[model samples]
Target: MNILQAKNEIKNTVQAYLSKNSFGEYEIESKNQRPLLLIGPPGIGKTQIMEQISKECQIGLVSYTITHHTRQSAVGLPFIQEKEFQGKTYSITEYTMSEIIASVYSKMEETGLKEGILFIDEINCVSETLAPTMLQFLQNKTFGNQKVPAGWIIVAAGNPSEYNKSVRDFDVVTMDRIRYIHVETDYYVWKEYAISKHIHPMILSYLELKPNNFYTVSTSVDGMEFVTARGWEDLSYLLYSYEKMLLEISQDTIYEYLHHEDIAEDVFAYYLVYKKYQDDYGIDDILNGNVSSSIYARLFNADFDERVSVVNLVMDGLLRQVNIYSFEKHCTDLWFGFLKNYRNHMDVSYVDHVKEFIALYHDKLQAELLSDAQKHEYEFVLEQIQKVNVDASLDSKSRFDCSTKPFFKQKENMESIESDLKLQIENAFEFMESAFKNGQEMTIFVTNLIMSAEMALYLSSHTIGIYEKYKQVLLIGSQKARLLDELAH
Candidate 1:
């Protein structure tokens, strides 16, 4: 399964494992719950998903790399204690709580979440001496004598032996004791993720032209040469930051993230074309429905690869609009919910659900579970909420009137965003129809929009005429030009 599918499966597994009985005890006892073991290649997001799962499930998380621990550290240090055996007193050895287990408890206390996931990375790459301890923990959910906290799910991720020679294959006994998920790389699946994440448009466009380069793991004389989804996302961040700073990205920088030479050089070459499009075609102008005839003439003269890159460029802009709409809608929802509740009640009790959203965002931000995009969204919303500081000294009605003023802007912003996005969508389709004689560009744009949950959500309440036509054209290839012409007329 792909990482997204794996994420869903693991989330479901965690929820099922944590299901409670009528008396509030776990439906399945702690001992009976099989710890989840995720086996896959490195850099496939096994580690990242745990943090997302923890945040989404509103649970505590304590993560560690097993390779970073020795047996003593993993199982805790031993100490001498006095014990009475029958009539005689004897010295006994006892171990303190394992640091890993202690961290789980710490998170539970810190977050006030009794249930969570304890994620162990590189579990099979532990030192030989710690291998038995690893297996023991997997089987018994214990690090030495201290068992994992009840209601906390144990999830471990490890690269397969093919990816890491250090991997210790679990025996049948150990394997039978856990729920194992084997993950693989799928470019289309990752593409959806990449689009949602707003990965560097150039990287996305380049990969779209060359899907084979998306995930590569091969052996060469120089050693193992590989590229993975992790590499692409990291590269995306650096590209975004470097471009923002107006710093020139070198071939070496690309190779640093993507170790494969052939793939790196190919991407670098395509990146030059992306820059060419940036310089030649005013993409923002195009999205605003202002396209010069000379620009279309230049595009017609360009090759298919460059045309595809341009399509991705246009799609990237449209998606950005969708992203903005999505964020504004969420912020508006928070304010709307709060005001609704406050208006219904005589007092601003519980401050409505806005406080919950704020608290949740703060908790995730504190835990560093939110991605950069999420962090910014949370911060912006937090800033907006802070501006409407409700004064307790004022009467309830006055307080509501003063504080509710800022949220009114959110409502207006949402309306403006909808209008802008609808116009942008129409402009993108118009430009796609005019620039390319063949409908592949429109095909690419419409296909991506269809895949976007954000676009689907926006379109539920909004309508785009060309989008409806293109969706039908997608089903009938022969009708693509007819549909484009129909929309054009």
Candidate 2:
């Protein structure tokens, strides 16, 4: 089972104890407390579970790392000779009183709990020198000459001895007194919690990376170590910029962080399988070539259904290994190229489907062009005005009054004409695919221009002959050319 499932089991087990109707036959005023043991992997949140239970039960949690305490810390130093008490002849036992009570009072205020919880993290990591003292405390719930506060409950967590070579074996005497709950990693449950919090999308995306497949390098002189869940979290933030790294990071950055080169090697190894396929045949050939004799000859030799299944499995696995964001960008660029080609030679039905997307893009392009044309016309008029103003030879006042107003008006009219002609030309281009509906190759643009009256006058009579092959879609001739000329002016 995963860490979350293990945690829930522990919580449920403790809740049963808490829910016990009778507290050792003592009246409601008195009770007996049962302590607990949490056993789990290093990063699997054993201590976190105890804290959660304390909060849910409305009890304060005080934690100490047993591994950090030594014989010196547990046993007080003797006082200086002269400073030692004379009348009472007290020993360090009197001073140990102050230290023990200090640990108790804080629990009283936080939980308002008649009894609170004492959380011992990494209990199994305690040094051999301090192990006897820990056993004494566990056996009697007392340290030094004094007992732990009456209302306090003891809960200890430790990584399994199997996890590390340094982990010392726990004596059966210490093990028998408390319950043991084993915890494992559970990314699925963590994902649910992360989603509920509405975690940042970018962070959530990294978290969603396949848990078993990712890692970073270690800085050991001998070699690299594997990354843990905690290491992944730290490296994710560092990799957010998505820039490729050059040299190595400093020791200070990764000294305490875990890294696993094996996982990284595995990921690279997975990638090479795809590369091997490419070396044998081109990517396009693999994608579009005959399957039976090509790269997938073995799978192609199978039944059609089995071959399809194998193809799907390989594709899905390869796709999952890819950096999705980059793959999506590549697909979008390819689709856009297809769109441009489709605009040139597709049939009417396909063109109509393509038009929906183009309609929005077309409006944007037209608006941009119209804005540029107006700016250019305005600049030209300004240049003309400047020329008239600077020329000492010209009549400046007449030049100012010389009907540039008509030119400006013509430009405005041309702007409107340009918009109209652009719409017609775009429409003609858009409609050319109509001839393809019946699978014909006639050039509709030639016919439309030939029939256009405005276009006919601009064209020599010889030019009309060029339209003989496309008489099916004739336009009204000069009408088209006049419209174009107006827009051009």
Candidate 3:
């Protein structure tokens, strides 16, 4: 149901066919070899799975998009040239895609290659002009204008018809030629594989937190998307590298997909779900539950509006998965009792995906009680929730279309009084005293008075006068003369 299982299924099917006999020309291979058509919403890992299969099978992979190549490139005529020098002539042939096809055949003859897989991505986008040429290749294993080499397998991928708005519907003729696989979001399966691969801790956390939201847009279809194994892998790396910033980026990414500004509703819904489950069944009880009659009733209720509640429930369950192992039974029991007593009426079935997820959580209470792996996963989930919060906050902040009152308004009287006081103080000490110039020392008496007043105006106004008077007194004393004698001298 998830990406990994789909990949194994595809590879196993193809490898089986290749083992039986060598498929002929690329066109013939399309006609004879196994051709798989992966159909999924954008971001689901269709093309990547094929690439992986190619590596695992040890076969060469030639990948191209239908949008990138034209009928001219697919089947047009090419140029040939000859050069004559010193009575000897050398000839060289230049062919178009048609001629290239012939060369591949020639090489296949010489090398006896069994076949290489041809991956055509975005096949739904093949232009009108190229369709017939491609049809020719698909039908006869040969270009309209030339022959194709043997030993080639064909695999084409595109967005699913329902989700993709742009792809021209494939006619019965084209549909008949290939086997189809539909990829959907499988959170638990992906989490397991991602963890096994030692994928980035952050990525694991995000998936565990909100499995439905993590996905990529498919390249071919406008508005079409697919979740891929690669995306999860990339997310793991991103979380590991940019731990704190990961949440912000994730929110922006998810925001684009959801196409909505108010994600808090979804987040709140999830929190409620987590609380309900944490209270109803012990974390262990929920994880170990097989198919409970009550659980099934909660999951597939016909009367209630499912869409409004399902996502929140699923998200909460994932959050709980990473955080629960660290919880002590007594604590869990106490919490459950509290929930049952306080909120016995609340529905918690939103987060009951048992066998799929192991226990994990962010709270130290949960981490301390859980296993090492559970704690790590729980922390990652917490990080993801934080990312969602950040994204929501930033997006909401940016929308400042709503009016807000200014904070800390300046009082007119206070402002004017402060301004006047500052000006008066500045004016009182506009000129510096000579004694206070850079490094000049003050008279002991002046220093004592200045230190006491702690007022620049008082000090500045009297500083020079006091210094002058002290100097005159000192001079009169040094010369041993009265004031009148000094003046006469």
Candidate 4:
């Protein structure tokens, strides 16, 4: 399975475990539950998926790299204690709480969450001294003499023996005690994730053209030449920051992240081309519905690569507009809801408290209350409350306009922004239709848009008032269907 499939599987497994057992409840005799062992290549998002699962389940997570621990730290240190056995007192050995176990308890206390996942990475790459303890920990769910807390699930991950020299294969007896999942690299599965994460389009376009270069690990004269999903994501952050600073991306910079020489050179060369496209294509003008005849002529005469770049450029611009509008609507709704609740339930008591404070400090604070800044601050809150209540029954766009009035400073300016976004979406739809009519292949472009729209839909469903505002414009039926077909494949 690919990483995405593995992520879903892990999520389902965690949900099932939580369903069968309530928080802080565990039975030692139960045979239905077992720990998960994720075996995969290095840097293939094994740890990243666990974090995502923790967030999705709304549970706490405690992660540790077992290779970094010793037997003493992992299973705790031994201490001497007095015990009475057979009417004679004797000094016996007992172990303190394992650092790993202590961290789980601390996280639960800090988060106030009884149930969570305790993830140990590099489980198969532990030192020889710690190997026996790891086996006992997995099979018995205990460190030294202390068992894992009841509500926490144990998940361990490791790179396969083929990928890491230190990896040790589990014996049959140990294998029988846990569930295992093997994950492989799939470019298409990760492309959807990259689009949703807003990975640099330069990397996305380069990968689309040379999919084979997306992931590779081979021994070379330079020791090892490799590229992984983790590399791309980390590089994307640096590239984004560099672009913001208007700095020139040097060959050294590219090679620092993309370790493979050939792949790094290819990406750097294509990045130059991508920069050229950005310079030639006026995305802002297109968004404003100001595309000139020269631009259209260029599009008609351009090759497949240029056409793809143009489509990506347009799609990027459109998505940004939609994101901005959706974010504004979400914020406006939240503010309106808060103001309404305060007015209905808390305003009277709040005012009474203020009055009491003034009465108690009339002489000392009367002049302070009369100050211009304090008067303005008090009036501002009341004015905002009034404005929100007045616009509560209006449409989303109208409510947004009212909400942003203080910030935008002009109704016409806000309306103009709203109008511009609508125009951009319409223009994007028309561009996509024209591309299809002209027999231009836009599979990658369409797929990327669909993935972004799906992410937006997910967010909208999770949030209030965003779906009604963005669904029609962002996730139109035709685009949604195309994306579904892609996923089905």
Among these predictions, the greatest lDDT belongs to 1
- Sort the candidates on lDDT, descending order: 1, 4, 2, 3
User: Per-residue lDDT for 458-481 in model 1, tens only?
Assistant: 766777787777667575334553
Candidate 2 segments exceeding 4 Å error = 13-34, 75-95, 98-101, 196-209, 214-224, 234-258, 262-489
My TM-score estimates for the predictions, one after another, are 0.90, 0.43, 0.42, 0.80
RMSD of each: 4.5, 26.2, 34.3, 9.2
Arranged by TM-score with the best first, the candidates are 1, 4, 2, 3
**Tens-digit lDDT track of model 2 for 349-371:** 33343355445434433333223
lDDT of each: 0.82, 0.45, 0.45, 0.72
Better of 2 and 4 by TM-score: 4
Q: Clash number for every model?
A: 0, 23, 37, 0
Worst 10 residues of 3 by lDDT: 401-410
Pairs with backbone N, CA or C atoms under 3 Å apart (clashes), candidate 1 = none
What TM-score quantifies how close candidate 2 is to the native fold?
0.43
Q: In angstroms, give how far residue 421 of model 2 lies from its true place.
A: 45
Where is the poorest 10-residue window by lDDT in model 4? 364-373
lDDT of 3 by residue, 89-153 (tens): 98866555564365455544443344556666777757777777665555555565565444466
